[model samples]
Target: MTSPASSKRPLWIVAATLLLGAAALWGGSRLVWSAQQRDGGVRGMLLETQTGAQHSGALVPLAVLAVAGVAGAVATGGWPRRVLGVVLAVAGLWACWIAVDGVSFSGFPPGAPVWQMFLGRALTLLAGILVLLGGLIATKRAGAMPRLGARYAAPSVKKTARDPDTELWEALSEGEDPTDSA
Candidate 1:
């Protein structure tokens, strides 16, 4: 039997997963591809260049987070769902660690403020958290909920006219005085 709440839960989970995936993708791109400017000239002229090697390495974790988000979003039921949840949680933690590490490394150009450097990593971390939450929610709900196919399944109830002998036996079993009643 399907309840309104049961049906709605997965939808919300999927939505959250998608949102997280998008955020991770966007943040990862920013962290990986965006360059910052540094003041080098007498008049405070700035030059734009790619981020340093330390920040560049963060891309791998962000990519893992993005993949986990998508996998968590699509996975359904049983061990598969549980596995995805675990994956999401681990990926989120990994991304968070990498992002936080990036914050401490003074790799970006001087003109880029600490907050600016942290923004993309922060978003990546946030996306990882969302993915982890969604995966766990889905796993917790999966056990109590029936599968999609179960909704269509119904016990085959065969209805037939009551037999005379069966009715008489039922009356006798109940200690009913059928003859006296007549």
Candidate 2:
């Protein structure tokens, strides 16, 4: 007995999850790559220092959180969905923190392009907020909503086209006990 509203919730959740995940991935990559190319020659190109030591950024954790958020959205049952919501919210908060830290650089270094830094941080912050909102919505609706898989399940085919005798025989052949009474 799935309602239209109930089915639509999961679809919204899935869409939000995907959008947030993509934003996080893109922003985090930009931040990390921008940092790596900060000291490069001509328009922040990495050609001059391609063999230089690479600096690791917050991209890894951000990616992990995005993956978890998506997994949680796809998971079955209330508890799992709620847990995933919490995870996504936390990830969003973490992304916000990283963005803030990046933007808080005291001195603007010549090597580091200000525009890229701000753009990356801004995207991360926006993505984090969106993800957080999505997570909260998921958490609130999870208890009352049907599992994502169950909601999309195909309806059972009616056997109105079959004769009663044939149906009974088919049922019995499928290991339904004939002597069993309801």
Q: How much is 113 displaced in model 1, in angstroms?
A: 5.2
The candidate that wins on lDDT is: 2
lDDT of 2 by residue, 62-104 (tens): 6666665666676655788888777777766766665565345
1-182 per-residue lDDT for model 1 (tens digits): 78978776675665567466556645654653245665677857675634422455655555555555554445455676666667666665665565566355656555555564566666666665666566566556656533445554543663343997776675665568556756
Off by over 4 Å in 2: 32-56, 148-182
Cα RMSD of all models vs. native, in order, equals 10.8, 6.7
Q: How much lDDT does candidate 2 score? A: 0.60
* Clash number by candidate, in order: 0, 0
Residue 24 of model 1 has an lDDT of 69
Give stretches of model 1 more than 4 Å off: 31-75, 105-109, 113-115, 145-182
